[model samples]
Target: MEINKFIDHTILKATATEADIIELCKEAREYEFFSVCVNSGYVPLAKKQLSNSKVKVCAVVGFPLGAMSTEAKVFEAEQALKDGAEEIDMVINIGELKSKNLKKVEDEIAAIKNVIGDKVLKVIIETCYLTPQEIVIASELAVNAKADYVKTSTGFGTDGAKMENIKLMKKAVNGSAKIKASGGIKNLDTALSYIEAGVERIGTSSGVSIVKELKG
Candidate 1:
């Protein structure tokens, strides 16, 4: 498999600097990653840096915490698209889901997807914080909301993607939406494993290293 095409090279830390984003875009272009995922604040920088390259710029909305209001997330997603983001990886309203407020979760996701239009929207359910049943529920909600992908984690949560969670997510979506397995996927083997398990995208900061390992 051409793993680079499946990888979304990511750097979402609060302290990620301009130089960091520049290097990220540079590496993404050189490595030919599917996209360079970054914070909304760096969307314009990444867009400018990767303008001449095929590497797309992906921005995060609601980020590690999906506690923001739907209107706020919609505004953030809209601004990101205007700033040149081609894809959005948004965190789900975990609190609402846990509280059994399915409508809130579904509406929030649908609201963001509604604004993004044809652009990709990957809803992050932050699987580590939820039970297996919650993971299934969130995945189903993403499918109903018309999200492009159901993502496993934010890479800032208690844990990253797990194979079991990916399996559950895939089954829940039932091909209605694609799958993105992010967080703690740090090696070529792990990345391939997720692909074999039916995930369509892999979000990780270890893209360069994983590709290097593949080359070796």
Candidate 2:
């Protein structure tokens, strides 16, 4: 398999600077990753840097915390698109999900998806805080919301991605939605295992090492 196609080369830290983003984009192009996932503020830079490539630009909205109002998330989505974001990975309203406010969670995701229209939308379930049942419910809601992918974690969370959780997510999504196992996927063995389990994309800052590991 082509490792480049399955990667969303990511750099979401608050400290990531302009030069860092430019370098990230350059590496993404060099590696031919599917996309470069960055903070919304870096969307334009990433777009500019990757303009000559087929690689897409992905921006995160309502990021690690999914507590922002629906309007805010919609605005963020619209703005990201305007700034040249081809895909948006948004955090679901985790608080609402935890509180058993199913509609709120669903509406939050749907609103962002509506704003993005045909563009890709990957909902970050932030599995570290959720139970198995919650993960299933979130996966169902993401499918209902018309999301293109249901991603595992927002790397900034208490814990990163986990294989068991990814397995559960894949089963819950049931092939209706694609799966992106993000966060701490560090090496070739782990990445390949996730792919074997049906994960379509992998979001990681360790993309370089993983690729080298896979080929080494």
lDDT of 1: 0.95
Alpha carbon lDDT at 84, candidate 1: 100
Q: Candidate 1: lDDT of 192?
A: 94
Best by TM-score: 1
- Report the C-alpha lDDT of model 2 over 96-204, residue by residue, as the tens digit: 9999999888988888999899999999999999999999999999999899999999998889778888888888888889999998888888889899888899999
lDDT of 1 by residue, 28-97 (tens): 9999999999999999999999988999999999988999889999999999999999999999989999
The TM-score measured for candidate 1 stands at 0.99
Q: Report the alpha-carbon TM-score of model 2 versus the true structure.
A: 0.98
- Quote each prediction's TM-score: 0.99, 0.98
For candidate 2, the per-residue lDDT at 73 reads: 90
lDDT of 2 at 26: 89
Question: Where is the poorest 10-residue window by lDDT in model 1?
Answer: 63-72
